[model samples]
Structures are given as structure tokens and as C-alpha cells.
Target: MQKKCTLITAAAGLVLALGAPVVGSLPAMAATAPTSSVAAAATTPELGSGGHVFAHGIVTLTSAVYDQGRISVEGVITERVRDVQINAGHGYQAGKVGAGGRFSASVASDSPTFELRFGTKYNAYNFATVESVLWSAVAPGTPPETPGPRPTLTPLPVPADPNPAPEPQPQPEQDAKQPGMPNVLAVSGTDGGWTNDFETGAVESLFTAYDHARREATVTRPTDGTLHVQQSSDGVTFTDRATYTAGGGIGKFTDIDVTLPEGSSWLEYKMWVEDSSGRKSEAQKFFVQEFPARN
Candidate 1:
């Protein structure tokens, strides 16, 4: 049997001779991307600022201007795919001047000839003109193009089964309440009704809570009071929802909350109140503040 040489070396002496550090020496550093790649990825598309195409529809009236008041022009709309409606009174006369002054009249269905006119009092030459003919189309059943960045749809997370049972499902949030006309309260102090504190100059209330998303106004009243509130988008027919009792006084009063829609510049709230003795209050007008959503 050959004699084996047993050489025992200490760990410290081995490390010093080899000039190598131990295994657990220094902390690790985080990984980072290159600065150039980061800057390039941060770039975004620039939206066009000039005029662009609005809708794909034949122009019933090509750049037509309304010079004389109450002037009517007849034209035919060819290849009428969608509802070819004329927007006569939209630009400057929305809900302000009478409907006859500025308004849109729908062209007859399947008829090539359509008539358009201005109000009798519109005498200013080149005052108004039809900017464009607006219409809608029923698109065929197909997958629409994806807008903006590709959305990473995350799958619903599921918990592991404890006893080989089915996983629980996530519940969806309740649908928002549909908008409706606000309630109208009668100002009669009779029948356990409370009188409206109209001692102040003017008091008005709003009942409808709008999300400013759907862009539909179906006003509805929330509570019972002596203040009568109504809703109207066209300003022609007013829908009464709530009524408040007037505590024998002379000043005007109202109680309502006006929730403005998103991207809206202004909101108009109209109220109609009456006294106990069948005295109708003047129509009160309230302007809503512009509200923008934060990212």
C-alpha cells in the first residue's frame, strides 16, 4: 500500500494565498435599462391640429350660407346611407333664440330633394352657414380597429381549491342609476307639508345626478320638499318632478343639485316654484360650473 500525503489547509490561509474573496461578500445591485431606450419608449404620438374628416356622407348642400332670413333651399341627398338630417339651428342658436331662428330640420326619407331655411329675424348677411351635414351609419358586424395602445386584459384571478371545489367568482359593481326628471314639490302647507324657507333672495334645487358620460338627461327628484324642480334639454317642454311649499313670503326660493356632465362648459338648471295661494314663482336660472375629470 502506498502512503498517502494528508495536507490540511486552513480556509483563511487558502483565501489569502489565492487572493479571492469569500462567497458572501457584497450586496447585489438593481438592474436598469439603458437611458436611450428609456427615452425612445417614452415618446407619444402627436395629435393633428388642422381640420380633418368628420363623417363619410354626401353633402346635401355644399358650403351653403344663409344670407336672407327665412330663406329656404331645396336639394336632393343621393345615396342616403344613414339618417341624413340637417343641423340648421345648432351653431349659435342652441336653446337660446327661438327654435325657428336656428334649428335643424330632418330631410324626408329616401327623398333626394331637401329644404332648409333660416329664421325671419336673421337679417345679418353671412351671419350663419351650414358647416357640414352630420349623419350616422349602421356598421356591419365586424371587429372594430383597436384604438390607442394595446390593452393588456388581465385574466380574473382565481384562488386554489381547498377541497377540490370550484373557485369563487368576482362580483361586478352595480350599474349606475338611469337619469330621469327631477321631482316637483307642491308648495301647499297643507297635509303635513313643510314650507320652503324662501326669505332669501332666490333659492333653487337640483335633483338629477349626471355622470357626464352617457350624455343623457332623465332628471328625477330625490326628496320631498316645497321647492318644485323641473328638467328640460330643449327648453320647450318642461318635465316637473318635485314641488316645495312656500312659507308665505315674497322672495323666491329653490333646492336642487346640478351635476354637470363631463367635458361640459356650462349647465343650465331651470326651476318653477309657487306660493301657497296659487302664486307661481318666476322661472329661476342656475348656471353650472365647469367640471373636468382628473387622470
Candidate 2:
């Protein structure tokens, strides 16, 4: 009876195993199907170099902040020549061929320094170079007039519900003049004197008086004429130090070096001109100031 019972139990277990489903087999099939599909789609495409071959690969150029960066051809050659020459304007040249090949060089930190151009042509290929690339910390294509440390801004405190009315504008300062003054010419720092020839007359007037601080002055005359002005420590003595002539009415600029006497405090200037009609114009004061401390 015991043997018969054991045989019956074994046969029942085998029947149950054949009827039940297999666990974890479905997950294996699902994973392998997607993996094979992904592998098939990941094939790498081959790149061709056409007739010309680059041994190091393609060159790329880029810039940072306010700079113009470039990549040009460079390398040594045995058969054909490969040379770069700079022209008058910012120009350049580059190429590769025959027993020689091409290389690439970046624009160094010292930019706007040299022009560039290519040498003789070995084949029908026409190679050309690029022009100037300007850079600065402020903006692209803009250079700073003076280079120095960057500036930082400080925030101001805001008033709480400040309902302040607008203040009245102040009257402009009256031009100082003496009695019987004739042929008055007015000049100011804010005026566009640097680009105008009036600076000549203005500078000349300044030098004829007193130049306390040894500051240099430049005067560009109208009709392209230039006059240098120098003055003695005592306001009485003045000199027309030098002059430069140009073709157009827009005169060239001349620099005037100042040499002041030690311990001088104040300096004054006056300018006058005589016309062909024997009429002398009244003298006009140009610059007056106290001497700055010596460094």
C-alpha cells in the first residue's frame, strides 16, 4: 500500500509540473529583442576625404570674449612651395599640395599685429587669406582705447516712497570777459575741439600765457595747419614753438611740451592776431590754472 501511494504522489507531481507555466523566461526574451535592435541601429558612418587627405583631421576655429580667432594652413614642403606672406592691409594665405602638406595656426594673444598672404600657386587652385579680426574685453570687433583692470559697480540705496519734486535747472556759467574785449572766441573741454582746427588757436593762446604743470598741448589748425604753443612760468612770456602744414584745411596736429619753473603757483594765457588791414584783434584768454604737485 505504501509503494502504491509513493508512486501515485510522484506521478501527480510530474503532471503538475507539465501543466504549470515557466517563471522569468518572458523577461529574458523581452530584453534580448530590444538589445539586438539597438545594436543594428548603432552602425557608424564612414567619412571620405575626397582627393585631398588631412593627416591630422579637419581644423576648427573659434574665439573667446572679445577676440577674432582663425585657423590658417601651415607646414613644411619638399617638392612644391608652401609659404605665408603678409600684405599692406590685414590679409592672409594658406594651402597644401604635392609632396608637401598643410598645417593650421591660431591667432596669438597679440592680435592686430601682422597681415597675411599666400605664396605662388602650384596648381589651378586659388587660395585666399582672411582680413583683420579685432577683439576687446568690452565688445566684439571693438578695441579699448586704454587697457587696464576691469571696473566693478556698487549699488546705491533706494529711498522709500520718495515723492520728491524735480529740482529747477541751474543757469549756465557766464563767459568771463573784460571791458573793451573784441573778437571773442569761446572754447570748452566738452566741445569737439580734438577733431577741429580751432584747437590750434586755442592751444596757441594757452601757451602764450602761463603753463604751470608741464603738461603737453597739441593744436590742429583749420585748413590742415598745425601750431605748437609753449609758455614761460611768468604769464608775460609766450612762444609759437613749432608749426606743421597739411594740404587740406584740416591741419595736422603738433605737440607742445611744457617746462614750468619750480615753486610756480598760477599760470595765465592770452592770444591775439593782426589782420592785413593793420587792425589788431583784442587778445583772448585761453587757459589759467595752478601748478599741480610734482610726482
lDDT scores in order: 0.27, 0.27
lDDT of 1 at 195: 25
- 10 residues in a row with least lDDT, candidate 2: 1-10
* TM-score, cand. 1: 0.15
lDDT of 2 by residue, 1-295 (tens): 0000000000111112333431211111100111222122322111111211111111111111214443222222221235433322343333333332232333333333322222343333432221111111212433213348988988988877678778899753344322322112322221122211232213233322223223233322222222223422222232223222222122322233332222222223333433345444443444323222233
What are the C-alpha RMSDs, in order, of all predicted structures?
Answer: 42.4, 33.9
Candidate 2 residue runs with Cα over 4 Å from true position: 1-260
lDDT of 1: 0.27
Candidate 2, residue 195: lDDT = 19
Tens digit of lDDT per residue, candidate 1, span 197-232? Answer: 211112343333222111122332333422223443
TM values, all candidates: 0.15, 0.16
